[model samples]
Target: MSFARYVEQTDPPRPPRETLPTMYDLPSENPEEPGLPDEFHDFQPELLRITFQPPTHLPEQVFSASDMNLYYNVRYPNWYKRPDWFGAVGVPKLYEGRDLRLSYVIWQEGVSPFVVVELLSPGTEEEDLGRTKRRNDQPPTKWQVYEQILRIPYYVIFSRYTERLQVFILQAGHYQELNLSESKVWMPDIALGLGLWQGEYAGIHRLWLRWYDAKGNWISTEAEQERQRAEQERQRAEQERQRAEQERQRAERLAERLKALGINPDDDL
Candidate 1:
């Protein structure tokens, strides 16, 4: 019998997971060079940074970065993890109160990231999802550095292809997956929530992860706020015009009635 006919006659089929190369088997990086980010990686992080509003902190006290190398180890000083997007509350927006930081050093900053978001990429999926094993000599993996060493409070992962969002919160020194309802995760400590927003951002409209207020409303960007203000002004002007037109018609009717009664309306005026 042919191989196809024999398989069709078989009672149970073989699983692809057994034969195919798993994520672990794939190389995480090339030793010679760093990976280049795609367009989604650039745009998504910008949206998160723009909309991130920590209610309790001032604008200058909240620092959010994208594709920035975060150095965690004090001993080695060179070991770092590059997050797609990360937000740190209670930290000065400027490093040492004056300069923009090229990278975030945990030891110098003394404040760990309040939240870290990683956009899923096929090349780094294993490490991003904490599926890869850590070597004994090398520094901790990205997941280990974020969860164990840095102890970041919130870790979020989003897959563009599947449009799936996963939220993990640090509880009792461990990371626990949150059961998000409608793709929303609320952080009571920061008084803000993160959810998937469907709208145009940077001239592209799709599902983007963004911050929302406590009342479950998506936080607006500066451009969006301006657009809303302009719309409100237009509506007010329209209402005023309608009111003026009504008053003018009423005055004209009264003038005609006075003329019909043999009284000159202009003489009384």
Candidate 2:
């Protein structure tokens, strides 16, 4: 059935949108699921969000969040997965383009995430890699949902401790792991690439996964761009100061030559 048919609410007297559990009503966090508790989780995903600039999408049309509940199943609306980071284009940054989304409800939004990232931690490593088996009565595993159900185009896993990046792309209705011959992998669909870079982020110097442009240049954050501009301005000012000093010295030498000729240096003034 079409997603619109699932949430059809034209009958006025009782609109399903109004009656259904909106993001507001759904539980934000599921304590039963194993959660990755690390400060790296906070910083890495934040960097992804800052540099996630999709050339084809407007700023308001791009939406991404970390550790946010993503409600995917219409049958069990309460079921959700909190990804380390997930991003989608062609969706409003705000829920319904007005309110902030407490959770991303697939039926209501009608858009599945284009990419989902899982930061590897010891607790969730097996499941994140889709190595765990689920019983018939149990809810589907993360891999099953992303590959067989949501069919997210790109699934990324980054390890902070190992600084390893493993990317899987959906092909033929299944995820085929891309060979990471190098540290970087390009996503032609998104017109960007993800790579491991050794740099200082959030005051910590280490290899962090970040996005790069089609030209293979790392995308700069707003703050990083601002700092670069300021440094350029400073260099320009310094060059101007040096030019003025050279002109002043030339004038002094001309004045000395005029004095030797017995001509008043101030006469030109």
Candidate 3:
């Protein structure tokens, strides 16, 4: 089917929620899928979601998901892609501004992802990087869905095993690999930069793909921010205590000097 025709029909979509399966009706997962969420898969996306704050968008206008089924086609309502993590700006935090989304239906939502991240695993490395070919009947690979169908602005892949980061941007109607300096790429549209940071996430000390602010500071997780605030408070308290102690010592010296000069230290003025 032509893309134009798909659009014509989907403007008042008949194949998605009203006529065909919606997120609530569609099955989210299959045990047969090659790549499944492991420990890192769980932690990394959580970190991404927490740290992703677009300067231009409101909190309600930005939404991020991990391992959620993203249905793209109105023609093929069952066709879906489960990106490791995807962020969409200018979309409701809930499905249609009220209900929580069980899955991200592109046709229904009427927006493509701003950025999609695929956490590479050994089992799915070939397909994740667009190396493997799909049979004619199979749904398009993750690359085709994100790059061609969805036309997502940014595509990112990170491998924990090798500690490598790769970013691709849609250019000239195709994805072009971007040259990264220090394993970092800035998405100006999103007003955020992503890079590899050597630090502890969820108590695991390793190099991880993390988001950075415009100043090149790693966006802190909520817990990390809380810790930083606590530290600041402690430092301020310590400084105040030191100042009080110094004042007390100075007052004692003045009293001693007055006593030596035959003037009672406690005398009324």
Candidate 4:
């Protein structure tokens, strides 16, 4: 099917609330198909958990937790895409009785993810780049999904095999490729940015997506910070012990000098 025709028939109107539940209320797990690989399946979830945090509270805007699946019904009902990691800044904080949702339903959430990241794999390479062709009746291509419909501010794709990072920023309702310096790009929306650093994360070392400060310093994880603190404490303790030993040696010298003078310290006391 041609990509152009699919977008023509898709309904631009929003669905009614009574019809179906939003994506957020559903489970984040995909029952029909297992996602990516063992490494991605495990680490991606951890990334979602660690990265997902809302900004300050507001009357109309709410924050979305990471790992929430985003869904939109287009020409094809079953067609959907779940980014390995995602974050929406201006969504409501709670839904119904729950703290939030498992997936982000655009029709229901009333907002789209500000940023979406896809961990590239051999199987998903074509689709992640919007090169996959669906039936002519289907909606926009994967490229169109992030670019046109979602209009997400930032879209990031990382290939583990190649250790490459690509960034897309929304401009005039379309995505323009952004230039990177040394494999790193900054996004002020998430109060962080994406960078390709050769280091260990979750015990695996390769090119990895990690947060960084505005000055381009790598942001350390909680565990990394703790390790640094412990090392500093150890150094301080060793210094104290050395100082005490020096004092003890000085006292011994003074006592020896007194003894040589036939003035025993004990007798004087």
lDDT per residue as tens, model 2, 1-269: 43234334421343365567777788887778665597899999999999889887889999999999888877667767778999998999999989988888888888899989999999889999999996745767899788876889999998887878899999988899999899888887778888898898888998988889998889998889999999999999999999999999999999999999998899866
Q: Kindly report which residue stretches of model 3 are placed more than 4 angstroms away from their true locations once superposed.
A: 1-17, 34-37
- Give per-model CA RMSD: 14.1, 4.9, 3.2, 4.4
Q: List model 4 lDDT by residue over 44-65, tens digit each.
A: 4465445343333353354534
TM-score of each: 0.86, 0.89, 0.91, 0.77
Lowest lDDT block of 10, candidate 1: 20-29
lDDT of 1: 0.84
Candidate 2 residue runs with Cα over 4 Å from true position: 1-19, 31-36
Which 10 residues in a row give candidate 4 its minimum summed lDDT? Answer: 51-60
lDDT (Cα, 0-100) at 248 in candidate 3: 100
**Better TM-score candidate (3, 4):** 3
Residue-level lDDT of model 1, residues 116-184, one tens digit each, is: 999998998899999988765666788878887788999999999899999999987778998877898
Displacement of residue 115 (Cα, Å) in model 4 is 1.4
Q: Write the per-residue lDDT of candidate 3 for residues 1-269, one digit (tens) a residue.
A: 74344455555435435576666787777667865558999989988999899888999999999999899877777788888999999999998788988889887788999999999987779988988765655766778778778899899999988888989999976789998877999888878998888899889998888889999999988899899999999999999999999999999999999999999989898
User: Each model's C-alpha lDDT?
Assistant: 0.84, 0.85, 0.86, 0.68
Compare candidates 1 and 4 on lDDT and give the better one. Answer: 1
Clashing pairs in 4: 1-136, 24-103, 62-91, 69-103, 69-104
Which sequence of candidate numbers ranks them by lDDT, best first? Answer: 3, 2, 1, 4
